[model samples]
Target chain A: MESFNLFASLASAIVLEAAPFLLLGSFVGALFEVLVPDSFIERMIPKTVPGQLGFGLFAGMVLPTCECGVVPVVRKLLARGVPPATAITYLFAAPVINPVVLLSTYFAFQSDLTMVFWRCVLVGIPALVLGGVLGKGTAADILNLPKPVLRQMDDIRNENHGHDHGHECGCAACGETHDESSRIRAVLVHTGIEFLSMSKFLIFGACAAALFKTFTPSSVLDLMQGNNFISVGSMMLFAVLSSVCSEADAFVAAGFSMLPKAAMLSFVAIGPMVDLKLIPMFLSTFKRRVALALIVVPVVTIFYLCVLLAYLEGGV
Target chain B: MIMDRLHTILEGLTTALLGAFMYAFSISDSYWMLLSPKFQPLTATAGFLLFVTGAAMTTRKPPRNVRRWGALCAMLAFLALACWAVLGPESAFAPDPPKKHTPMSLELPEPGEGFEPRLTLNDKEYVRISTPELFALIEGTNKEYPREIAMRGMVARSPDLDKRGMIAVFRVNVFCCLADAVAPGFLVSVDDPDKYPQGSWVRVAGEVVESAESHANGEISLPGMLMSFVSLNHEIRGHDVRIIDPPDMPFTFEVRDKEPFAY
Candidate 1:
């Protein structure tokens, strides 16, 4: 009975929390597959250092998925020959530094566009730069997954046999091979499959959050308030442990005004990239080593910048 | 062919679901807040347009011209919602005003000493209030006022009473529907054990106390409740608070526009 109640609550929270974003994320992913030129993007990665960073950041802004929702999409983007650095930057920054998230963060902080702008710039810059520096034309096969899943996905894409997908001319270029009816069916099945896979993790995160709010003692937060290195470290740790989705993180950050801006920024920057919840998805989707390196370098760099800013501002 | 049909059905369903989500989010209902702020009035409008456009483009049965119209309308709707959220007067899209706390004087309910009135009334208790009630009476009073106040709300974060005779309190203030709903703090606890049990929506007639005590959550608490009278209805199961205008609106706007309220 107790287990049933937990399951019920978890289900309620997941449906409530994940439904909208999951729908939006999957829809956007499908749209990208349809509308975006995969081969064109593959050819666009500049060999220069700054160019790679810029492309990575740009990709992050254009892609609309949240941290939780971006995994599979990032994997697909990588598989299509987008540079590892670009893929990694997009993987980390897409959910955290996107236009929607940036605007929402500004609104949450009551139109502090400077904070919004700096956050994106600060996080996006380093993520792109570090990812570029690390990837540096690494071998591609190391990142590739088993052949079967790719083949199956390709088959589904080719079949394109669902809904009004039989009609060909109106949709994206991929519509040529498969009729409109098949394409619609393929997208639908793809979406449902993606939802089933990620919704459980989303449900777990929501339930954990709800439980934390209900049971955790408020006195515990006092340890996090301050401008010192300890405070920054604690906040980052809290961010990782909480595993909050990027969309909802600002509010949590706002609830604590004592934490320095740099630390707060780092928390937001690092949480989506390195948290335990997202790590599994990262490993499965990208090369585990590449994923780990991408996350670690950004987190460390962002943390140092946070401390530096706090020191300069005389916050601690 | 069968797979194609199933896929089409799924696409149609996806479009409908997205449209329904946007529609539901656009209306700020009373019970809950939508989790994503991106699902604002503008987003909903855009999503609707996108749904229509996506619907038009993907479906073979639709007329040829429908896709263009759908795309055009979707783009237009997206722009409109974006504008409204960014520039609309009702939006918290602008910078927040500086915080000012000039506690409005609120009328305090008579501090009944020896024996308190039963807060969870077994029967309906008739209480009276002045026709011209001062907002001051309720503003900062920590205790429940004896006034017959009619504040409709949904049970928010009403946690079960701990062994220490305290319960975590929370409520959802609705400017619209579940979407755009904001969770405001209205922490209530009783001096006497189990006096005001958790999840009970009562017209608390008391003074909002100024003294601070450490909360169960370990944060040094600033405000607390000192209830003089409480009237709760057992029939009000899952009593969700739906306040149109909460007494404190400063932070509410930000909360509403942030997660759990955004569509």
Candidate 2:
């Protein structure tokens, strides 16, 4: 194929395949804008430091949004007086800890629960570590969002007239027409906005992944094979480059079956936590230093941890 | 006030265009070139949802745009991609030049240790099996004698197979999407090369032969059939490589939901 055709084919493939999941994510992200009142999460959060970290680690089981959807939720959490650290913990935890993502990881590994377990452990450990560490500071310390972006966060929070939806019944049977429709509209508007906002990074990321996939040859991937430590870093680096969603990245990792299990684990683990596309999203929500910390903390933790696992592979 | 509404409208318009582009591409004939047909339903449904969401944005009140310039740039970027997707030539999705170097990957597909074969000796009249299913069968089939399986695939004249007058019959197997599609095929020994042209769709029925060579060793090496405990591939040892019309279903689905082929 001509370079352009190959480029188009791969780019379009990545974009189209991911569009549905991205849309679903945007819808949910948008819904969080209106339906879940700002005060709701703040109230639910346990006051204790450990409680907050624990909540972030396991919240995905209750709410199964992938990495793509978690950003918006985290942003919303920050806006609603949810501690930046706790919200950051949720941000890290939501992608891998989530049920849908876990299930996808399981199926992609040919129904093996082992891969799923490792994926959770790898992701859980980081979010657990980061949630408490990163979660320590105030919104300004934790979130270095540009002034305008921070203002937008406020705008999203102020949507309910700075009012709590607590008085609103949680049940659908209430048949509250006025509240429901407005709620629905708010969700849609948010969905539209979020999709438009995030898709810029998504399209660019997908295109880059395709171009890399198309132009780079097999020998390039196999370079780090047999060497578990480098393989882990290499695959993790690839994960950052591809920026594939956690729900679907297993298939991509599985593509390089030759990569050590440790490497594949790192690929899936570090991907949801940080990536090129996600960096911008993180910047939009976090302080520059804080965002840099989010990336550095996990990348270092996961890489070394994965390298350790790679060394221990035969011992166990 | 007017500027806010206009920004909202432009946002709506950009989103609507994105939704429309998705919907349009999903239905276009060239869609298969971009994504596997199995994903059509999901892609189209998403497009519909996006469209509805975009339409709703027109009436729905938007949070004030704190960053108007950024929003405008996003709108333009979204519009440009959507426009390109809609108007791009069909060749954009397929190869304009012959795909000379589209090696499936550096690594061979994972061995089918736990996978069930697509066909068995008990099953009569071999019909069609996807490349992945066929490879799995070769690796997992426990039958003592080769199963008489009939299958169809496009001819890939690979030098790696290294057998004269034999061609690798393969199908594009989509594990997740087109981006992850791998060309997995088995070798078919044919009597004539003219009848079985390269890239021609053919149906061949034969006694399955397992290769002694281990398969999926990163590099695909098919010496013949890698029968149950099958390392990687299986071979169709028959002279009956007949020309056949391409099957309607363009790509194979996940193994669990695979059947219901439009043969």
**Which number leads on lDDT?**
2
- Model 2 Cα displacement at B32 (Å)? 4.5
Shift in Å, residue A298, candidate 2: 1.0
Candidate 1 DockQ vs. native:
0.05
Please name the candidate that would achieve the greatest DockQ relative to the true structure: 2
CA-lDDT, candidates in order:
0.45, 0.62
For candidate 2, lDDT tens digit of each residue in A1-316? 3455555555556666666666665565445545665465677788888988887677666665557557765765665577755787888888778665776676556577888888888888878777777777766566666445776755664454333333321211111112324667756766676666556555565566566665665566556766777789888998897777675676566545545788889988999999876788778767787788888989999998888988894521
Instruction: Report the error of model 2 at residue B119, Å.
Output: 13
> How would you encode candidate 1's per-residue C-alpha lDDT over A1-316 as one tens digit per residue?
3232322332232234334444445555455454555565667788775676677777756655667656655565655556667766666777766665675566445466666766776677667665666557543543556545664664575455332332211121122232344555546433433333333444344445434433334444344444457667876777777676665555445434434676667666677677776777667655677667666776777778777777885432
DockQ of 2: 0.27
